[model samples]
Target: MNPNPLKILVLFYSQHGSTLNLARQIARGIESVPGCEAVLRTVPKVSAVCEAVESSVPEQGAPYAEADDLKHCAALALGSPTRFGNMAAAMKYFIDGTIPQWLGAELSGKPATVFTSSSSLHGGQESTLLSMMLPLLHHGMIISGIPFSESALGHTQSGGTPYGASHVAGHEGRAALTDEENELAFAQGKRLAELAVKLAA
Candidate 1:
């Protein structure tokens, strides 16, 4: 184990609890690594109409992620709910605020992974995941993805992809994460933490 626990910031936006559940599973997987710790954070919602004021801290669940979280993290795992084949606006807004970190190269050379949940199987899980990766790539972080050999990818009738971990919450947007989806999410997190350790060395 490393002397300092590898901290992987699990930042995500969950509107219907599906993405939030996935984030918890991923955090569990990260902490499973011998020298890794999971820092769970969530972003506040934004209004589409005009200025939507959110408290500095959220009313419930993890506080709004801070720019400093990116600075100190050994790795990152980002998650978001689907929004018309893309990540939600709130998550995008949060990422957009990381310009300072990007300019300072604070996240450069870090390992990162993305996860998403959709209302339907074809609701653009892959697209949402790719969209989330773009900002991390601009920050110069290496993108990590789940391998097909995970078996869950091959067996998941609900949601699993080689691109990254995902869940099909169905049109009803349920809370239950299928067994295969949960396994894949955990696997992805574990892989990210392991890579962070190796990179830190």
Candidate 2:
């Protein structure tokens, strides 16, 4: 691998914190791998009002992600709450601004993964994960997903997918992640980090 520790960016957009929880679990998995460091970052919400602007730094939780984070990350784990079978507007808006990186192939050949949260079991978690992958694919990222070998993937009643890690946040979007969801999220993170190390080497 590179002499320095690998920086794995854990980037997400959460409206009610379920997605953030998944991001944290994924980060834990990333850090479990020696020489891999999890760098947590978030994107600001987009406003319908033309003049509304978010502060540079988030009020709490992870700081806002910058283009440089994408440029420098050895790998990425992207998460967002499901928005009508797709990624949230905030995440999409942030990704829409990554044209410069796409042009330069800044994230090309890097390993990446996706995660998401939804309010119900059938709330399109897999589709949300797939939606997030499109932009990363355009950037030439190597997408990674949880495998069926992860036992939780077969048994998770609420949320777990081969596409990636996911959580069923339940009604009101306040449900804590189930044990299976947590395990799968961590596995995805660890798996992504491992791939990053090998690819970088």
Candidate 3:
């Protein structure tokens, strides 16, 4: 790890690969900023039945995100899949559990941005991003978004947005991210990191 890197947490819940892809892109963006580090994490799946269970640790990929990780981060990049114009249940479940962090103002004044992926072009990507911002707002995180100045926003025919970063994964949800989408996601990540470092200074 680079000494004095501004650690930014990239947290999400991705049942499918699209959200995970977006997370990876955002992490790359975060790493582009000098002296900023990206710590990727994910939330555990919630079972339908009360007695159903999952392993304490995930079987693969990044480890489950701890609440303390949110508290200590200098900034955050939140991502989730769209579920009826809302965020995924697993992601919502994780955010709801951060009451302690909110009460303590752990994330207050920190920069935050959100991203989402959906099957349809009109699949409510913007709403999903906005809804995710609600909890972060309660925590007093300053919102960050991609400005139109990024060329990707003006030219993308697929998934790029001003709300943050988004991708149109098609109905099958297996489409590779377009070059434009990837560029915008990286831009968003870099923008957030730059803002965080400036605020810290």
lDDT of 3 by residue, 1-201 (tens): 567888899998888788888899999989988899999999888867621778878889989899789978999999999999999998899898888898899999999999999999999999999999999999999999999999999999989889989989887877478999999999999999999999999
Candidate 2 per-residue lDDT over residues 1-201, each given as its tens digit: 537899999999988889999999999999999999999999988887622766788788899999899999999999999989999988899999999999999999999999999998899988899989999999999999998999999988888999998998788676588999999999999999999999988
lDDT of 1: 0.90
Number of the top-ranking candidate, with lDDT as the measure = 2
Give a tens-digit lDDT track for model 1, residues 1-201.
Answer: 668898899999998899998999999999998999999999888776424566777788988898889899999999998898899998998898999999999999999999999989899999889889999999999999999879888989988788788888887768789999899999999999999989988
Provide backbone clash counts, one per model: 0, 0, 0
RMSD in angstroms, all models?
1.6, 1.8, 1.3
Clashing pairs in 2: none
Model with the higher TM-score, candidate 1 or 3: 3
Reference-based TM-score, model 1: 0.95
**Candidate 3: deviation at residue 119, Å?**
0.8
| Cα lDDT computed for each candidate against the true fold | 0.90, 0.92, 0.91
Which residue segments of model 3 deviate by more than 4 Å?
none
